[model samples]
Target: MLAAAAAAGAAIWLTTAWLLNTADHAREGTDRAKVRVDAVRTGLAAGAGAGAAVGLLLAFRRQRHAEIATTLSDYDAAERRVTELYNAAAEQLGSDKAPVRLTALYTLERLANNDPSHRQTIVNIICAYLRMPYTPPLDPTREADPEAAQRAAARRYHAVRGNARPAAQPTTTPNPNEERQVRLTAQRILLDHLKFDARVPWNKLDLDLTGATLLTFDLSNCTLSSARLSGATFHGTTDFRGLNLAGEARFDDTIFSGLTLFMEATFAGSANFGRAIFSRQTDFGGASFSMQTSFERATFSNVTNFGGVTFSKSFSFNGATFAGPALFSQMTSSERATFRGSTFSGYTEFNATMFKRDPAHELDETTSGWFDEFGELVFSRAADFSLATFSTEISLDGAIFSGDVSFRSATFSGNADFSKATFKQAVDFADAAVADLSSPPTLPAGWRIEPGEGATGLIVNT
Candidate 1:
């Protein structure tokens, strides 16, 4: 096209020059003809300049087109190569051999590193592999009678004395060990890529490890979009410290057989731990929930700590059971926090906890509305509420207390309701401050209140 444009420009310049020269010769003797000749010559130069400019523009455009074509061709070839490598690695993952599967995992990792667009897909594949049902191999000799097997082997060794060869030692199967190693490798690949400062961080990838039986599941300091670990079983310590979850976090029916840590984690979306079981120490200290947080029907079999947690939205522990010492000291709730129908079998502590209505929050117009609900909760052991502050109304209605309970030096800036609450043991409200005397909190039947000073302070006992 550029060549054609250059030829056309040349043709136009030559034709104009021929016509001007012919006209100049036709009127050579007149003064007007001299003026005309000079004018024609100038016109011919301008036309030639215009034509040359057109040719230059066309040439530039053609070069740009050619460069674009080359770039596209190269891109096509690179894409094809990437596709080939991806398919080959995916195929290797289907091999029965553990070594082949491990190789495939690494290959996929390499491919993902080179091509970021495929990172999420590769992550999905790796997680799917982990979700497959797998059992660690057992030693055959151990599965049978280990003592008999050992004795038989010893006898065979003794029988093969000087001339013959000794009996082979009992050999354990290699497949289970190999398979376990492969699974570990897959897990490591995920951790390596999920790091905050990783060379190829798969940012905000959704994890679907539902029903997967994982070992030492650690996702600490990582950011995720969502996670589906429902019904999953973790065999080792699970760490989720400092995790930032931007979407729903589902751990319903999950079992953590080891210590679980979620300290300083941030949940930007709803968090569900319904019916989950923590068999060991579980700590969620200093965590922040920006949305609804639920622990409904969950069980903590060992020490559970939730100190300094911040619940920005509604939080619930309805029907949850704490079998060990439960601590919620220094926790803060901006919205409604409920523990209705929950049971605390161990020492329960809510010392220095703060439940207040946010002044900036426009949702609750009534300053006297109840924001903390512990209705129908049962404290089987000693319960403490020392120095706890409730800025809005709080309800302990129908709660059952079988052990010593204290509300020493607690401050209720709003109504503190204890209507119909049952106390089988001594209850103390020494030095408790109630802001609203116009509608003072009700004490349980037979409870006695001792007034302090004139009518400003009261101490209740049951």
Candidate 2:
């Protein structure tokens, strides 16, 4: 539309210019009367042409804006409907009516199938339902309908007696015992939905596990694309080991009192654990995130080991609390990683880790936020430590970050050894306090420290 309007405007402008030129030439040679008439005609045509061009452009712009608005509205409505269906399914699972539960599941499936944006959400909803244990032992003594039971028994007996099988032997065809097994097996299929494809619209389906108690919800080799688990309680150890997720996997306001092992889990997705509590030890020793991940405002009451973990993506740990000894000794991250406003109550190690930048921008103004001292490595890029506290020894023996580093307003209660650490650019430890001797820890030769009143740059050779 814009193109059409622009073309019309150009044509009108050119015509007006040509007519004005003709009028001027006539005034110089032809009769004054004819020249005056030609001038008036040219003036009127220019005014009309310019007016029409301006009106057309305005109309096209309005139309474009309205189209955009309509698209956005449609998208919003679809997203809401998807959410409604998901909620309905969750409620239906708790319903006593079997038909209603089946209908809910059917509706959820339809919603997921219809909207590409809600696909991941539907997957999470289904998985959540499947994970909910709901199996009751059958009683063979109960007979609601004696006549039907007798008929079924007679048929089974005839089928068995007519065959060459012994009379005492049970009929092997269509075993009733297998009927319960089939149902259980169907229920177990829910565990397969551990992750979803991020290419789908609304890739992240926020999961809420609030008040949920599972003795053990095994999601091995499952895909949890965008699963929310807020305020949920896992009474027994929850095994999410060897799982792959794609979208946002939230665990906010949740409680894990038992072992929460995520060993060998791959998160090619965003992971959040904000304001969650882990009362027992948590292990993420071999987990990997290929996208942005966060643990903001989380509380860890026990040992949390993330050693040998790899974050080939952006990561954050803002305002997190580690109440016990935490380990992150050999983690590797390729992009920006932040641990600002975090409190570590135990020894933290960043030994033998590589923090690299994207290969495309490897040498550009982009610096890594991980590296150590003495030309070794700390964080590779813009690693911030604003107002972080370390209760025990903090070692940056073999860390590396290639950008501006900050330890401003940080407090370290134990020895901080940055010996053999390298600072690629500016290393700001201004207003930072560390418990060490006067000749504080060995730092990068050219790095500047904003010495505060009685503040020492980590005692050297301590």
Candidate 3:
């Protein structure tokens, strides 16, 4: 549009100049000459106006182009500075001094806050730092000898005072306490950015903490997209209370050496804990699983809780070993949930639990053959399923109960198979409801059988 305006203005000016020159050559005294002069003056005035408009338009265009060029230059400079700062901080992370590494971590965090485009990359760097092998310093105060504590304190004092003599050569290993502080700082950086109410939130960031050794890890009320913690070892209390996982959460082969809490967590995708080990008390109370969850071959060495959990998809505890009391009270499974081949070395409770399979719910081919299977499960202590309800077919085909077992008020809406189950101690089925009793549950011959009032199925007592 500007070019067209300029061209039209130039054309008008040139035409007016030609008209003026033609009028200037005519005789001046006659009426025709005067008319010619007046016409010449009018044409000259129009030419001047057109010239002014063209000048203004050109000036405006040049000013706008200059402004745009300045903006581009500024953007280029800002990008270069950001790159330089990022590179410098990254280099500092590789410094041999722990304090320098800590400073670098904070600098990277600030850079991420100021630059949203590189937030995820900065987070990945921090997680990668944490993924590196780290061992927490053992507390000397815990030792039986007082001399250990004194030695640790003296070393710390000397380091702080900078009075210790420098080594002739750089040591390959970092000071335990200094390295621990750096690791903790790195962990804090991640947690700070991941907070939901962060000033600069990094939401849905995928974490790769695989094989990382974390101490006193707490991620309560945080939201994550996905996490890979396979083979990671957690020390001290590891809290994941109220965590919201939007994608797969892998903890395969991970070890929790301290109390692990997952109370009220929501898993929107598959959760895998295959071959994991919990060396202390673990809690998953009131958690919700929206997809397939597996604890296959996992070992729980202390008390474990799964009370009030909701399984919206297939769940398995196959080949798992529970060495302490196991609680599944008030648990609900919307799809097939199995504990096949699991062993309970302590008392097991499934009181008031419900396993209902929705006929409208579709299962994949891999899970279509799954049922509420407890086949080959061994209960070393009392197993309780009092007041439990099963709306789908359930199988305990080859389970062995070393202690007393109870199904006192359980209701089975579908076929209940106990084809080869063994009850070595007293077994109770008082007032239990069964859908099909044609193939009665295998019971020891000496056990007494009684029928409850208005109950169609026979109750067993041993």
Which candidate number would show the highest TM-score if scored against the true structure? 3
lDDT of 2 by residue, 242-352 (tens): 877777677778878788899998887677777888888999988998777878778888888887798876677766777766677567766655655566655444444
Clashes of each: 0, 58, 0
Candidate 1: tens digits of C-alpha lDDT, residues 146-194: 8987998778777777556666666655466677778889988888878
How well does each candidate superpose onto the true structure, as a TM-score?
Answer: 0.82, 0.43, 0.84
Error of 3 at 391 (Å): 1.6
The positional error of residue 292 in candidate 3, measured at the CA in angstroms, is 1.0
Global fold similarity of model 3 (TM-score): 0.84
- Candidate 1's displacement at residue 408, Å, is 0.9
Evaluate all candidate structures by whole-model CA lDDT and list the values in order.
Answer: 0.83, 0.61, 0.84
Question: lDDT by residue for model 3 over 46-130, one digit each (tens)?
Answer: 6567766777788899999999999999999998998898788889888889989988998888888887788888888888888
Question: Runs in model 3 with CA error above 4 Å?
Answer: 1-9, 13-35, 140-172, 362-368, 435-462
Q: Arrange candidates by TM-score, highest first: which order?
A: 3, 1, 2
Higher-lDDT candidate among 2 and 3? Answer: 3
For each of the candidates, the C-alpha root-mean-square deviation to the true structure, in angstroms, is 5.2, 17.4, 5.4
Q: Kindly give the stretch of ten consecutive residues in candidate 3 with the minimal lDDT sum.
A: 439-448
